[model samples]
Target: MSKPRKPKGRPISGWLILDKPLDFGSTEAVSKIKWLFKAQKAGHAGTLDPLASGMLPIALGDATKTVPYVMDGRKIYEFTVAWGEERSTDDLEGVVIRSSTERPTEEAIRALLPKYTGVISQVPPQFSAIKIDGERAYDLAREGETLEIPAREVEVFRLSLIGCTPHLAHFEIECGKGTYVRSLARDMGRDLGCFGHIASLRRTFVAPFGEEDMVSLADLVALERVGDEGERLAALDDYLIETGEALSGLPHIAISDDQAQRLKMGNPIILRGRDAPLATPEAYATARGKLVAIGEVAEGEFRPKRVFANH
Candidate 1:
């Protein structure tokens, strides 16, 4: 029988809330971070387009397990829509497909905000990452194939017009998961009969993380100047947020060392005491401030679903 292969690099774990710069791909950013930290595993919670910038939460090592929690959270974006033309990709990168001389007034734009807010149906842009018949929509778009993409429901918690000019308008939106800002621009343009496309877009927040938590790529690159490899790695490690911080929205329970051990060994622990929760759909267990496992409380027992390594 063959032995298992040993993983390479250090097993560092935590979240790195990156302030992604414009024109940089999310996957490329993850690769750069992993290499800089010399970590064994890395992944990002959400996909930010190369055209967009700001708050990209990245998980390193064991923290990758909490990515779903972050992705499901709400997000906020600030964008500019330039009137007079619509593009193939619905953004500045694409070629102009339609043009119009008319422009929507500031008052008209503000009046349209209510129609977009709350639960609404939205059609995704053609040059998007959405799958169509087992192939990426963007790939088909690049091949010059026009697709009849279906509309899906997306919740927009709030939508407001910030400022506007004869040729441009600025807006901010807070929305639920799967909301597409590009489609909003396109739909508004088509509705107002002015034709428009996204001139600029920046995501300022992804739920559970905000601007204050973001670290720039340039700042991370500067840490590489430390001469000693160990000191350099330590400097980078200082920026990582605790893995449990990602699960702040979930119910949490503190357990004893014995309980932690049993959870690590894949055993369920009985819930005791008057204050113990009788049942919960999902909850996380911690010991001395370290995450042990994420599980459910049912029938007076805490069942381990996903266990974490000792940090």
Candidate 2:
């Protein structure tokens, strides 16, 4: 029999809400953080395009288990749409495929808002990460292949126009998961008869995280210059938010130390007391304010679906 190889690096766990800079890919940010923290595992909750900037919540070690909860949360984006030409990629990065001299008045744009707000079907941009027949849509697009991407329902909780000039318009949107801001710009341009593309886009919020929680890339880089190795690692560790913070949107239950131990061993704990929840589809269990497991509450017991290691 062969012994299992232990994973390399420290088993650090928590979330890092990054203020992703423009032109930095989400995967690149995760890699950089993982290397800096020397963590054994890491992942990001959402995908932010290289062209976009702002809040990107990254999970390290045990925090990766809570990524789905964060990804399903609402997001807010502020973007600028430049009227005149529509690009093949639906952003400044792509070449112009259609052009129009026409510009929609502010009144016309405001009137169009109602049509896009709430539940509406949106087709993702051609140069997108969406998979098609086991291949990426963007890969096919780079090869000069045009595909008829299907439209899927996305909800825009709120969509408002901030300001506009003859050639440009600024807007802010709060939307549900799977909403595509690029598609919104393209469809709006086509509707107003003033072909347009995303000039700039910034995500100010993603679910439980907001602008206030974001740490700039420059700030993280500066920590590397700390004189002592121990101090430097400590400085970086200070920036990590608790793993349980990502599950703030979900129902939470506090358990005893004994119960926490039982959960760690993958055993269900019986719910006692009248205050205990009878049932919940999804909930998180914590002991002494530290996350222990994410589980389902049913049949008067808390059944763990995913367990987390102690920090």
Candidate 3:
């Protein structure tokens, strides 16, 4: 009398695009995924504000180690900004602290959009998690000390005025990582002479993942109640572009089994065919595919800065 063994849960790897719900922080989504999959390791590609909602990429197990690649991907956001107002938190989360000097027209907003496109320097809102020293900037803001944060360079590949209302304007933005939509709205208000803040925000895409892969909180709750986490997880695969595919834009060079073995043992992969400069040494490795390790180009070899998991 022998009993057959059943597989635990699906050995989920790669990325997960959760349509993060309002009121749930990025960490909460990760927690839910951890409990649902019983994943030993998991992490989000980027953190989302509780007030905002949309595509939040969650990495499961070995996928968690691939977070760095995901984090650097370009982000797309569709957000509504309310004109003639301002908030301390930069969005609806804060109290109204100021009013606009004039009611902005659609033409005015449209005219200003071009200025924000391409590479630009913008300061992140005080109510942000950017760390200065060991403490968060938001923590300092809450403590009532004047925030003296500095401006940073961010690339706004595209900023389009999608729709407009008398008081509300919706914009679609494709920007580099570290770009804050809330700050963009705030700065727009400043440019328009009518201060404004983000009234609503929804991330439409995180580089490769789009609305098609998004999963709402209602769906997650229903799946949890039915004890049917597997089916729900299947719906998420379309959103996860896999870490390797995500980094496909970078140059690649395959290696022999012996070379891979050596690379895995912390040796350089001895890169070839790249006649150009490189970024960080750790930035080249992809989670899937032939990308086994990330390294730097030196005199003649790409020294292993970091190695992907063997399996």
TM-score per candidate, chains pooled: 0.97, 0.98, 0.81
309 Cα displacement, candidate 2 (Å): 0.9
The global Cα lDDT (0 to 1) of model 1 is 0.93
Could you tell which candidate, 2 or 3, scores higher by TM-score? 2
**Candidate 1 lDDT, 33-101, residue by residue in tens:** 999999999999989899999989999999999999999999999999999999999999999999999
Error of 3 at 287 (Å): 11
**Which has the higher lDDT value, candidate number 2 or candidate number 3?**
2
lDDT of 2 by residue, 1-311 (tens): 99999998889999999999999999999999999999999999889999999999999998998898999999999999999999999999999999999999999999999999999999999999899998999999999999889999999999999999999999999999999999999999999998999999999998898788899999999988888988999999999999999888878889999999999999999988877876899999999989999999999999999999862
Query: Which of candidates 1 and 3 reaches a greater TM-score?
Result: 1
Q: State which candidate has the highest TM-score.
A: 2
Clash tally for model 3? 0
**Tens-digit lDDT track of model 3 for 251-290:** 5555666777787889875555554345444335433354
Give the per-residue Cα lDDT of candidate 2 at 73. 94
Model 3 lowest lDDT segment of ten: 279-288
lDDT at 212, model 3: 80
- Model 1, C-alpha of 129: deviation from truth (Å): 0.9
- Tell me each candidate's RMSD, in Å, in order: 1.1, 0.9, 5.6
